[model samples]
Target: GSASGGPDEAVRQADRLAKDAGAPASGTAAAFVNAARELGMTRVSLATPYDEAQTETLAGYLRAAGFDVVRAVAGGPASPAEAAGWNAEAQAKLVREAAEPGPDGVLLACTALRTAAHIPQLEVAAGRPVLTANQVSVWEALRLAERRVREPALGTLFTVLPPVRG
Candidate 1:
């Protein structure tokens, strides 16, 4: 069953489970926010493959995490399979289209969408950092494990060290 109170409840449940298992708790939502903060991104544009409602929820989550979502565009894909089928060029176009003049970064917000292959191109086009869900997840996992690895082809998120969190 879905969490009764949306993302907040989902996070709480994840924390509970992690504690029960004697492990650190981490969620993709928190990872995304932390990644953005690490990059010093205060404002961002969002590109998602979800419908209007899901997109709005995602934007709200980002907002609650302290990001200013200056622009948001949804591709309205009917299913995850459709989202995954989106090619690099199409995804780059969506990122470019959704990007505004002053956002600190552009976020491609779905793990289902094929985004990693095009992150470099998207970052160049957007003229800022471009973070995809899968990329951030990997980064966060490494961070939680106290491991640091740098691979430039994966984009700045990997190439640069994450900021220290108190």
Candidate 2:
């Protein structure tokens, strides 16, 4: 069955490791949630290459992190290698199909999906911001490091600075 709390725990563990290593902690899950919030996105659609259970788990994590997952679609790839080989056209098509009405953004889940290469096109096709796991991870790392995000090719998520920390 799909479960929750794993992502939250992962974030906690990353922070703990960073502290122990005497380095700045970069909480990926928290950073993803904050990225959505910074973009004024409270609702999002999701596309993944995992099976149903994994999709459900990811949706649950996103919901727990605060965004309402309005829709989620799984591509059900047989292997990570196959998923990684999925062309940008296929990825964009899946994203478009999963993009239902009322979603503030579209999330192309799974780092193995090779989504970073297609984020700009997907965003334009979906008419909204498109986020991928690797993209979000990089964004979070930059934000936690107090660096400005400015990669226009990665879509709007990288165009603006993260919310100023107090």
Candidate 3:
């Protein structure tokens, strides 16, 4: 679910809803931040399938979580249908271009874009982590479930995630 007010409020609201439902919830922005933190990334570049306004909103959320937004580029298909049509090469190009000039990592912030297969390649080119929403979401879910997995193909995150909290 998208944030209604702001990033902090969205996190609080998600916490309340999760408490009410008696289940753990993983908000995408929160999960992204946590994964970045776990990887010790301070400076980040953002590449999104959103338009400028939406992309800035996502950057705002990341900034609120204390990441340094060193660069942000918005391109690619903003809609789900268009994003679904985007291929691995296209996603790689976007992430690689966004990571220029050296940030600690790049964040691909759209769940609609297929990114898992390209993460390893992108990280190699960027010489830093390339985190996708779907990737971090799954990592956070597994962490919340107390399941430990180390899938190197996913990117550095999979190989270096902090130990599960139990």
- State every prediction's TM-score relative to the real structure: 0.89, 0.87, 0.91
Relative to the true structure, candidate 3 reaches a TM of 0.91
Clashing pairs in 2: none
Q: Which is superior by TM-score, 1 or 3?
A: 3
The best-first sequence of candidates by TM-score reads 3, 1, 2
Stretches of model 1 off by over 4 angstroms after superposition: 1-10, 162-166
Model 2 quality (TM-score): 0.87
Which candidate model has the greater TM-score, 1 or 2? Answer: 1
lDDT of 3 by residue, 1-166 (tens): 5733567787887789889989888678888888899899999999988788888888888888788999889995379888867898888888888898799999988888888887898787677899999999999889788776889999998998565466
For residues 37-69, write the lDDT of model 2, one tens digit per residue.
778899998888888888888888888877789
**Alpha carbon lDDT at 129, candidate 3:** 93
Which pairs, if any, clash in model 1? none
Model 3 stretches astray by more than 4 angstroms: 161-166
Rate residue 109 of model 3 by lDDT: 86
